[model samples]
Target chain A: MESSRTILTKIFTDYYLGAAQAKKDGKPIAYVTAFTPVEILRAMDITCLYPESYAVVCSASGKAGDMIGSSGMGQFAGDLCSYSLISLGMDHAERLPYGGLPEPDFMVATNNQCGTTLLWFRLWSQRKNIPLFMIDYPTGSENTDQNEYVYRQYLALIEFVKKQTGRDLDQRVLAQQAANSRAACKLWSQVHVLNQAALQIDAAKLANALFPIVAARGTPAVCRYCETLIHEHSRENENAVIAAQPSFRLLWHGYPLWFLPKRYPSFNDDRFQIVLNDYTLWWDLDYPAADTLESLIRPYTSTYLNWLPQRRIDWTEQLVRDYAIDGVILHANRSCRRALAHVIPLRDHLLRQGIPSIILESDMANPDYYSPEKMNSQLESFKESILAA
Target chain B: MTAVDPILKNCRSMVLNPHHRRAYLQSVSARSCGIIGYFSNYIPAEIIAAAGFHPLRLIGCFGSVSGPALCDPMCSFVQDFYATQCSGLADLLTGLVFPNSCDSLKVLRQVWQTRPDGPQCWTLDHPVNTDGPALLYLTSQLRRLASELAAASRSTVSDEKLHAAITEYNTIRGLLRQCYAKVEARRLRYSDLLAVATAGLMLDRNEFTRMLQEFAGSSLSQPLSGNPVMLAGPLTDDLELVGALENHGACIVGDSVTNGWRYCSQDIATGGDIYTKIAQHILSQASPTAFDLHRPSLAARAAELGACGIIFLNQERCEPHVHSYVKCAAELEQQSIKTLLIEVEHGRPGLQARDLMRIESFMELL
Candidate 1:
């Protein structure tokens, strides 16, 4: 049986192989962000690359610094999203992993994630001289009207793809893709539900498992990985009755530092284990069969990124109860304003519900904004708060 | 003093002094039902006005300390706002509105919502893609906002009131256009002109229109000296930045900044429903916030103004302007126009020596 690392490695290695083969076959490569509706491209038989994932790999491999440093001379600001900058910097960097992201024929991004991604994709599209098809996801109430608004935009996107790629969208293929996404999302949710049981693995392992889930949603690869994750956790649940015991379980809010996952557990001292994070759960979406454009637009518009704070609060409160969480760690990531800005209210609500929470100020991708000594001290204090509770 | 002189004097008083302006806002807002404060330029001020509320644009005071909750990488403008709120400066207003203009404002609204003592808040989702559906979405938001304001202020916003508000706002916009035309024709000082525009944001609509009418009708004459330059950026109402350039003899003839031309350049269509007209007018403007994938409107505005050059003042961490101005500057250079790009903190003090040198050098090149 292959280990989790081997699976991750194969997934990453196969992704590049797929890109190279697509390039050789003269297939159109569409660079997309994580929140982009890439299933459309999949239905159209176009190759797609997720730059947000590549940025994670760049940060993890410690090559992000070189990429960032080699970007335009003080052109990009230091305070902008480091993930987007690393992706932008890869264009001019002297070195990159796996020969860096290939030049794309075009790009597509949805504004559901954050406005920064929209701007980042726009800048990249202009710089790369590629046509961009953007789907606008206006924030506010997620009523039927908003769903229709997004559906109309998705139809326009289909027309744009047909015009650009010379291939019309196949409804049968879209339905299949939507069905695949629903299956994968259901399996992913089941895996999280199983985490409610005494899990043998650490939070770092859970976070690592989500990389493929984020980059390969709606694909069989994700379904397979999630199955393996559930199997592994089930086996561990029977064996580690002693090791799974902890001072208290923690519910983490905000994006994690992919490059420095160890920075969190290094100071944990086995006192607590982070049970789950918001980003991993951001994709547990359910949509109907994509026989119609409305079904296709439903999942994209209903993602956590499009949710209001009140809805998010209700969801967070549900998770806190379901996971038997003892406390919360909220990272006010400097790079992620949309996610970071709302966690304060979440923390306040959690505290009112008798769940102690701490706010950690740091950036997820940039190490310059993180201080280990400071974070460690905070962690120590947070541990004491849990003990008292 | 003559009647127009007192009008001009009151306008200058409100425009030039923050303390006096706050006092005036308190006095009028007390008499009136609501003083609806807004942060972004995309919000329809007419809705608040039609709801019988004073539409006060919140400008962060200089030298005010923001809350520690706001950390590094936040542009100074938002920090100043958070500071203003924490320092009890925003207590005079009844409520606030936040538009989806940038990520910083989005986050600022979320943080402000967490504060128990903060004013009532509303967040408007402004669409980037200006299509038919986007227009409908904005119109719905405007209707919702108007309804909410009516409930909050206990003042009904009838069709007549909305039409009246739109007409009043259109008049103000027309007078502002005339003011900028005068500045472009080198008949008005940019600093004094900006002061009048900023004052209108704080004062009553009728009073503001009266002041603008008096200022436009006045026979105040001044020599248009220095190089002709157009200012461009997001939400820069800092008088000191303009004062710095004017001190160095740079004639600010026109601008594409949010607090400048972007505010006064367009008018709501008088034909459609008030909400539809407001949405149409907002979508018609050249928004740097929106990723306008067309001919660079800023460059077009520069060319139309016939200015010798353009000065793009951007906040350090501002993503929208920073992403485009590099390409914008290059495009302007292609048109044989000089461009100066200066990075400064929002609401910070006057320009540094290096920024002054860049401005001077650009002027010399022009």
Candidate 2:
């Protein structure tokens, strides 16, 4: 009978509890990025710690700026990836709020995410003097042979983990983990797909649901989390009615401002509501069945950031059309350069289709870099433009 | 001032004059020679040359601001290219190739691909790990790139052509080694040697070799002075920054930057499929790109140059150089070497005075 919020709180609380216990249990921990092949690590029975997700926790708790300040002195640059800076700072600190992360026994990452994470993870490996395993992904999908290379790297990573942990990667376990991952993604996709067509859920509620969707994929918890979220939305829509009959369905681009969630009223408001977000939907990518190496790695290879530019644009255009989006509000986050790369070009594309869009400049974590007054004014102007269009 | 050699004068003109370099590149296209831009120094020029395309290194022009048009945290180097694209200069190229070196460049590849007016763009994996599998993967990537370049240039890059390209580039690399060796030995002025090297990357392969060979053999040596320091970083296209360091009584005896010594230090192995050889050669060198684990060679090169100190100047938001410099500095410090780290936004005019003062203060300590 627990609400989704209560269930979410228990999931997060359990995550930290397990980490604390793992440290005491002499379990080997592998620090990883969100996009890493967690299935393999799970098969190897190594505890995975996602530092980037921890950075979000710190940022939400409003300690990111102070944490980053300490690390940015001389060892790290102020302009380096804020997620990395905050993580490094928290690592070097004597004490932290949510408790310190366990010292990593090893590190692993794939370049499918921004190349920054590869470097960020490398720094951790060097600092801790632990082994680092990597899989280099070619940027686009044109060369399927690139997957052959990745499959080889995957085997190499398995060899590395076996050498380090004295555990072998069982094909049976890998297949099951892959199946679990596929199920999680399928459920996650339903939430976004439903929201795109019908504004059944609000942005804030979806944002809360996306935390577990990002952090705890390929697990029973996330599968249930998604199902519970979808059920709640369905129940809410049973007797639900659009309060204002919003004239414009806008798409929110980039990471949601976690620290300041109330910036825009909930999507239930009469004004322009954010009907979709491409960034959140990126994690909802469905993975093929893991019958072979290619199928096994399909979950990682089919990542949104790893897609070709044309393919990304095509999918986005389809989403915009299906949702009947009036405009797109791209969060020009000061911390994330990869997402900002397509801002102008996408704006121009939407413009050609008679859609009005605006780029709201701010930071995802570092509020010092964000101007609330400026954002408010920009949003006001954007709303006016969308209405006019 | 010493009497400048004629070849040195032309090299200096090209290095100092952006318009002259632009005009020369324009003329290369008029002859129906395909002009392909390779984004970073890590890309093997022999592949493009083998495909009958001029492998023009595309470091954007130095004076413009990207102006709040894109994300604030994006590197200015990529931002400058975006700004230049809007200004219609990217139309001059037959194609563009980007090495998957860092986040900024990777994102720039996507941005360029989205532009309707942008030239044909291809992204290649420059392996971070120098292991056997990494080299093998890079060989496949290079072969793919050569095939793409051949199609773009409307020619076939045969094995024989690739071998010839390798030999030609190796010859230039050999001369550049001698050029940098002379600078380290104080037989050549720091800025003069750099100007010649910078000009070489812009000019035709044979013309650059001819001029650099002449410049390397010339006798334009004035007595070298000032405290010698090795300059190392990600990007150093700003000659003003180099001059500022020199003006502060710190002679740049050697450098390990994208536009500096890393360009010409390594040579391809002879007698192979040539693409595999190119991958081996590129992996053979230590990259300033982040994620490269070992950099003892950088310290060794600085020590061999007899530089009393090292100045690691990097652009802000350039994580690779920033992270690498810390480890490199520690290794240098263990050898009793002094290091100064400076992070700035390159291509901004009128910030030289403050930087020069910092360099001067560091020189005073030396």
Candidate 3:
């Protein structure tokens, strides 16, 4: 693992400098949340900024948690709640890479987890005196309401664009960006889909490529970057079924790429291939850039982990059949309770549907909470259960 | 006390009929009769009577059978209350009054505030000591809570009536303290004291005092072991947790928990002094409730009340208690008072295996 200083330096050099350069060059750089509809932002020619992204940068740099803890923000160790503390302490945790914490014209509060997070953002907006545009979800509604709520949040996307950048939410731009996002998602999905053939790319290439998907989803550069990979793969006929894509191609949920990066290779054993993860997929698929906001974002595709959670569960169902996987390693994440709670009923349902499911408890960040030995033991026994099934 | 007391009878029936507890709550909500919630037995009786609502002491989940859940068992109990609230069982709680003694109650107040139906809640920021800003805070919060309760219950927080409630609660506190002494000295089993405590539910303060006197007679069938096990954690009048620990090789010797011990001697004064004792006692009780002196240094508390071992039952997710756990453990160990730390998120769930293991290990060392 890279040290905190190294990660901070890299984030500073790449995304922050790039965003600053883009802003100076008269190309608009609108920042949205991780939970915000990137297609909507892309349509407005706005760049995305996940507040949580800055939060992670602060936490990894070892400032966010400490400052938050010391600043009477909260007792992370006391509550054993890393999520609340990290978020409450995001601002003072570290220096802004792009200088002054991405003075985006507006901020968004997504109600995916506990509504307290929304409250946290509200207090933040009050403190910062920023217009905190809300991304409302249908409170406690499982799937259908969530999508409608996400769609409602999309309406604010246009309003925020008009307010922030003094430009109308051009439907043409959204549709074009949606198309670009779809193309990128397709490429990204192909990259994951090719994992069925195992070790399709070198470890370094795969790790480096994973970044553009996570951090640069709606960017033209990312679309071009992924497009190159697709073209290159097509020319080479790469990803030949490497040892019949392990019998257990598990869909590892939670923010794996960030929280428990060490556990990344824990699934690398021959029999179990962690086929798709939620971290990067949170950004894939934008609408073809368009004039109308509705038409623009209409072409956007989403996973269950997306604002479209119906799609999340639906994707799992489809993957269960399509991938012919034997089990699901439901790495139940504590920070993302909105996502983790979904797994309880899903676990029961999957069991009835004859799919093996294992729920392992963990906090997303600060690997201290995750017991790798315990999780590995659980999976090993669960593998036996699958074989028995 | 009143001929048309729909609330008091409702609370009694709910306690008696635990299974129908959920249904009874719906009826309370149907009438828009607000619930009066108290965290512990230390609750002032006059306040419940004045509030004109059934006093509800929501107990922890009922058993320890579901131990296999990876998380702590108390969390299951807490989830039970949360689930019930979400399902609208306790929706009738128009207002809640609680002594600020534990973080669990603090979190519960937060949860109650956010429920679909707005339950006007007030923290009786009771002091851990009889002095300091806690006195001012508690008095002010209680006065504010009085008006809020009246609005919810469709009554007035008449000063005269409030004085009466304080007197009644003070009387119960006085009697409970005397009874607690007997219980502490092994003169009586805690069950006798519990009977007197429960009698506070139906009987008025003076009447309840007489009943307790009658109950705490020189001779009782059950025996009280002199071995004082100081019952800790946010307590309830429903000594289920205490009794369970007793059943599992422990006894109720002494307690730091306010539900029983802290509120025992409270004597709410009358007039401008109406909020006087309740506020004074509550604030004095707010110190991190372990061995009373920030753990490891509990000679003051232990010597004040003779105790052999300390049982620390922290309400799970109740951060303050959990923080004090290791420190309390080390401190009690220093005193050679083997401490049992039970992380109870909610009280209903029985002794978890992890807790049972902890207890066994502690007992073995002792």
Find the number of clashing residue pairs for candidate 1: 1
Model 3: lDDT equals 0.53
Q: Candidate 2's error at B189, in angstroms?
A: 1.1
Q: Every model's DockQ, to 2 decimals?
A: 0.55, 0.62, 0.04
Q: Using TM-score as the measure, name the better of candidate 1 and candidate 3.
A: 1
* lDDT of model 3 at position B156: 82
* TM-scores vs. true structure, each candidate: 0.92, 0.93, 0.52
Report the C-alpha lDDT of model 2 over A173-225, residue by residue, as the tens digit.
67777777788888888877666666877766677677676766666787787
Cα misplacement distance, residue B269 of candidate 3 (Å) = 41
Query: What 10-residue stretch in candidate 3 chain A is worst by lDDT?
Result: A137-146
Best-matching candidate per TM-score: 2
Which 10-residue window in model 2 chain A sums to the lowest lDDT?
A261-270
lDDT, candidate 2, B37-99, per-residue tens = 887777887888888888888753533545434556667677776676666645678888888
- Interface RMSD per candidate: 2.2, 1.9, 13.5
lDDT of each: 0.76, 0.74, 0.53
lDDT of 3 by residue, A1-389 (tens): 33323443464466777766766776566444454556566666665665566555555454544645643333225344454456555556555334534555556654433333444454455545666655543322222323443454466556766787777666666666555556667777776555444434332234445555556655565656665555444426564223334666666655553443343537536776666564445454444444344443233323333233334555676767765667877766555534643455457667878988888777655555568788778878887887788
